[model samples]
Target: MKIILSTLNAKYVHHALALRYLSKSVPDARVMAFTINHTVESVCAELYKKITTDTLLGFSVYIWNVEMTLRVLARLKKVAPQLKILLGGPEVSYDPFETLTANTFVDYVIYGEGENTFKALCNANDCVSLHSIEGLAFRQDGQVIVNPPRPLIQDLDTIPSPYTSAELAAFEGKMLYYETSRGCPFTCSYCLSSTTHGVRFFSLDRVLADLRAMLDHRVGQVKFVDRTFNCSNVRTKAIVTFLIQNAAQTNFHFEIAAHLMDDALLALLKSAPTGLFQLEIGVQSTHAKTIQAIHRQTDFEKIATHVKALRQADNMHLHLDVIAGLPYEDYEAFQKTFNDVYALKPHALQLGFLKLLKGAAIRDFEGYTYCDCAPYEVLATPWLTHAQLLALKRMEDMVE
Candidate 1:
């Protein structure tokens, strides 16, 4: 099969990390990544001209690209009915009921961890029954059949290297992301990281090797995709120590729960050079009950103290996040939460509204109304009415 993986990225400099991973997962796969700013007609025209009967096009569906992807997909199915269209990635991975049935164009969906499953599905022969493929969901004879789930890859080193591939050199200067870990230690209901608990690490040797390759290639800042980059203090320290010891011109970004920062990480951060490390702290909601309702544990005192300490040290640039419309956080309460986080004087402060992601705790959650779209943003809840949410959005606009 002539397999190709693609997605419409939010911008030109932003490459789709999942698309690269999918392409790296299957050696035979080619990639066609584009930006969403372009019209669907232009993109579809270019893509439709290249489709061959033997081709299998797989899209790394995400919130930003789903609408655009569907538009192109509908046109592709009309123009080349014989071509196969495969869907994967977070947007379609969990509950594809709507995507599979509502859109007859999608031929197959490889749910969960897609690397191994996609390789296996592509290798399967036409004569093989759909039921035989694990982690696959398909429509057959007007009924959708979903295969048994595939567990997350315990050994992540098996996911091939996109850094070492010559084809990826074209993406230089476009921000790149590397995953050193998977899953999260905390169960924050509002986030998808809650789905997979515990932490899994890629071999330190493998990670260090990839970093060396990235640095040698002079690739720009590499952001670690690990949910909680500092979840394991020992592992985090080891990696930090290595980066400090083997100084490179490359900058690294991490999303760390600031409360988890230990004295060791603090000491390291105190002395690290400016712009070497950038940390993003998620202070979702400051209301005690709101935090508890989301099943997140945090020490605001420590977070503030450490964040201030780091800010004072002038070592790393800090970005902090706040979510509006969390449970128990009314408009007034949300303003308080915003004020609390905003007071930190972070280099960058993010104001994001709650999104009831398909598989997140808020999806079928009671007393909540969310947008009926790919992103499924929370419109309102028992705690906050739609008008209040809109007010909060306007407040967010003021600061952001």
Candidate 2:
């Protein structure tokens, strides 16, 4: 059986780390990554040439590229009806039945962590074997049957590091996504990570070894996909310390909770070379009520203090994020949020609109409506009107 793992990245500089993990599990699988810039006709044409009778094509879907991916697959299926297509990633994981119902050409959907499930699918010779695989969803007798969710991988070390000497060389001078952990400590209602519980970490030894490989190859930048890089102070410090001691031209980026920073961590960061570290802090809203409504835990005062401290260093890049259209946050409240975060003088301030993503807790809240499409950006709410959100979108353009 021939397996091909693919995804349309948001940009040419971005690579799909999820595809790499799945490919590692199924060593025979080939990875074909593309960017959203590619036209659907062109991508489908390229993929169609690789399909055969026994080939299985897997797509790692995201809000940014779900439509384009579906278009490409829809065309490919018309040309090769025997071709098997599998869908995974957060976009389809939560609501597999709906995805399958709408796109009958897609043969399977892996709802959760996909390594074990994907490998099982690759090894399965017939329909009976697929039914036994946990975390799998497939059509049986004209109805989508979503199997029970798979247990989270406890020994993360078992998931082989996707990086190899040759792969590292290929990834040089581009943004690479790496992960030392999975899940998040906080349950932010707007985020899909909130649906899962607890944070899982790969062994420190495993993480350091991977980082060492990237540094050795002189990769340009590595972005940690961990939901909260500072969830564990010890782990954060250890990783930071390692990066500092093994300083290189390679830059590392992490999405961290600013309030989690302490005097010791700040001091450790200050000692690192200038521009070696970049931190992105998400302060979705400054309003206490808004934060509570979203089930997000944050202390803006502490966050402000830490952000100011980090700014004072004048070494690393600091990017702050604030979301408009959050619950109970009217235009005036959002203005306060923007102004509050702006006053900190972050190197970059991102103004984002709320996205009621599928499977996110925010969808359960009443008095809110979002677009019924990919990205599902907020349309209107009791607090913010569509016109106000549009104005915010213009403001975001100017801010960028």
Candidate 3:
């Protein structure tokens, strides 16, 4: 048997990690992975030609894009009729039943976490009892069957590190990526990271081992993907101290909760070398009503002060973000957010529009209405109008 896991990740290094882990659990499974962005269709066709009858067997395709899933499935089916397809991730987990029923190409839908369920499906000898598998959805007797969800992985250290020495060696002096945690503690309504609803950190010793492995492989830069790297001040300080101790060999970056910073964190950050670290702070909006409406609690004044202090230190690069089309944020309100975040004068300002995904709080609210279009993004709200959204998008383009 053979299996293929594909993703639309911007980088090949991270995509290979998911593929490598899946391959390790499935015996004799020839696993091939591809990374495509805005080019899945053409890339799938190219890969189809490389597989012949002898090399091809039962295979599966993973869809992360709901908009492109049907089109890509149709293309893949024509190339390989025996291939089985699975849909998972945030895009499919939101509404699995409708997606599975509508698309004939998808054989199964894995909800929530996929690491264990994927291993089970690959090793199953009979497909009849597949419905008994937890965290999976499939069709049987013209009905959709959904199984119970698997518990979240508690011991993160047991999982193998995503980067390999050979892979890290490829980018000897360029880029490195690592994730120290799985989920976030905040409840920002617009973000999927908030859905997980708690903080889970990897073992400090395991994290140090991974960092040492990357450094030994000569990786110059490392980026932490934790949603809020500084949620636990103690852990944050320890990691920063580790980095500072190894500053001569590695440059580390983090995405942090700006309002959560304190004098202690500020002092440690100030002592780090310039260009050795970077911070990305997400200040979605400054308006109190807008912030409350989106279930995001932030102190704009304190955040501004902290950003100013970081800038004054002249040690690390800073990036800030703001979102348009959030509920209660009108054109004028968004302009204020833009001005406030921009005035901090970080390296860049990321102006984003609202995306309504499954399980988001704003999605359940009837007060705001969305456009019935392909992208399915929020079109208007009681406080924001359609015309205002279009105008604001234009302004965002101009400013960003």
Best by lDDT: 2
- For each candidate, C-alpha RMSD in Å? 1.6, 0.9, 3.0
Better of 1 and 3 by TM-score: 1
TM-score of each: 0.96, 0.98, 0.89
Q: In TM-score terms, which candidate is top?
A: 2
In candidate 3, what are the lDDT values of residues 1-400, reduced to their tens digit? 5565554554465443445554555545455544545576776776576555433222222323445545766678677776767767666776678778887767778777667777787666665768667888876666787778878878877666666577668767777667888898889987888778687778999898888778787777788878899988888888888888877656788999889988898889999999888899999899999888788878989899999999999888888988888877777888888898889988878887787766677787677777553345778887788898888788777766
Error at 91, model 1, angstroms: 1.3
lDDT accuracy of residue 103 in candidate 1: 87
Q: What tens-digit string does per-residue lDDT give for candidate 1 at 111-166?
A: 88888788888887763556787789888778888889988889888888766546
Better of 1 and 3 by lDDT: 1
* After superposition, candidate 2 runs with Cα above 4 Å error: none
lDDT, ranked from best to worst: 2, 1, 3
* True lDDT of residue 21, candidate 1: 77
lDDT for each of the candidates? 0.84, 0.92, 0.74
Q: Give candidate 3's TM-score.
A: 0.89
